[model samples]
Target: MRSTLMDIAREAGVSTATVDRVLNNREGVRERTRQAVLETARKLGYVTPPDEEGGNANAPVRLDFVLPAGTNTFIANLLDQLVTQAGAQDGMDVHVHSIEGFNPDSLARQLDALTGTTQGVGVLALDHPTVREAMRKLAASGVPIVTLVSDILHVPRLGYVGIDNRAAGRLAGYLLGRLLGKGAKRKIALFAGSLSYRGHEEREMGFRHVIAEEFQDLEVVELREIRDDRQRAFEETAALLKRHPDLSGIYNIGAGNAGIGQALQEAGFAQSVIFVGHELTERTKRFLLDGTMDAVIDQNPRVEAREALAMLKNTVLGRRFDYHPPRLQVIFRENIPEF
Candidate 1:
């Protein structure tokens, strides 16, 4: 006896109408829910109709995700979530690539190489001429592009899937400024992964703007080109502390939280200097508890990865959908949720 859509829906724990939509390749079904229905249909030995392109309906759509090469906990979390979520989806074939040293030429070459290979691309792009040219060319070649985590200007991409970085930076600045408590002329150190990344640059701009407008007593001293390297962050932080022992606060526009925390602890300024950074990883959580970090601005990588994939696939399939930007969460020790 042949199985029915009702049977598949029952097994998939979704409504029969949703199973019908999935089997018919109709719009309005979510990517994961659609995949779940499809998996159930396959398990029940139900044959689905051919897709619009007249290919195997079950064949996956190939997409690539390009991220920076680093051990940054947030990036690592994004990579992991990309893999895990794509694995759960039936129609997404996601390939993740890391750009070495955040090199523009290398990233451009990578984009050029992927021209004919992938149906879509989601890149954490740098705001460089070569990289922008590559992205424009790729978009011109009929492949859809989506910017993930970071965005580039004047690019013909499908959409951006990440938090509002400028707002997040302002929030960080506000937390640090208020925590320092009506400072009577205090210094705050700002670190960035690199200004080349549009996200980081926007964060720096917002942080500086808030400090200048609201907290006139606080002076922001920045050390350039940290590159999100732990050792470099540690060294620069140690030297900065030695030069200005009265550094009242520290705000990292990017990663290297652990290194900054280590430097503060070693200098015996962990409790004195209010530290705020990005990402709510295990280490950052520990820092929040131990008073090494005062606040962390976090975005859910799982939501980002899933959104990126959905945007890519929907564009390739010419499906119209609404996009919601991911929300940013400000976490402290008091409100840190269990993973």
Candidate 2:
């Protein structure tokens, strides 16, 4: 059994109030009594939790950061940046977690469990109704949630910390059109981690809108959902290419770059296909350097880490701060950043 203040008081022959003062180091009791109480607490293993002056301060802020599990280099890099930020920020006590694939049911359950104990949360959640409801309950209790890489619509939140994915998709469409440049009738296919993600869906919408209005010759097939698995991506990509030999381009708004690269190479279409994908990971960087990929849409993870931690700190501290959207960086073979 663990010890309590009353137990410490009983063992030391002192009042609970004196024990409280001594535990808080508030100063009032005589030095002899203070020393005795301290020694008793030490012997009893009574750890003093930091005082809640502003609720999550005197110590680090306890935040639950939930991500999806996979070899998605973009997410992996983002996770590393966040872990570094957690170590650097004395105000941020982040506990990182990962759920398998695009399972919103599990994500919702985890969100519900984080209430009442953790001060805040960060997530790359599916835009599902149950997940939103769970977030609503937590928000009602003043537990701030900041959605990273994706945003849930019509729900209260600290803020969304990512690029305008719609704009990215539109740019992707334009880039594809420019690369193919008045080529013979073209067919393009789009891939996604999952349309359940608002970011990926928005990207799809923007891609479709641009292809329809600006590039009529570029025809897009229905979206292929990979669930961010490399094997799934490899199989689906191989099947799609075999099914459509005339496929001119591909835009994977999600991830699994290695799978995409492998399928393209094995199918003997890496040189012929016009590819545009998101994020600047080592795999994608190699593709760009080797001329396997044409362009990459990168969201700067360092800036994201700094902004996300700041947003969580302000929200927990109840301070008003301006929210600015991070810029979307486009990389070409000629301008790849140092690996």
Worst 10 residues of 1 by lDDT: 45-54
Write down the TM-score of every candidate: 0.84, 0.82
Clashes of each: 0, 0
Specify the highest-TM-score model's number.
1
Model 1 Cα lDDT, one tens digit per residue, 1-339:
545555777899998668656654669999999878877766666653335345655778899988888868889899999999889978888899998747999999999999878888999988999999999888766567889888887986777899888998899889988999794888998999999999999998889889888999998765556788888889889998999898899999998998889999999999999999999999999999999999999998878987888877775654545676789898988999988
Tens digit of per-residue lDDT, candidate 2, span 157-250: 7678999999999999999998888856789999999999999999999988998888999888747999888899999999999899989999
**Best model number under lDDT:** 1
Q: Rate the local accuracy (lDDT) of all candidates.
A: 0.84, 0.83
Record all residue pairs in model 1 with backbone atoms less than 3 Å apart, i.e. clashing.
Answer: none
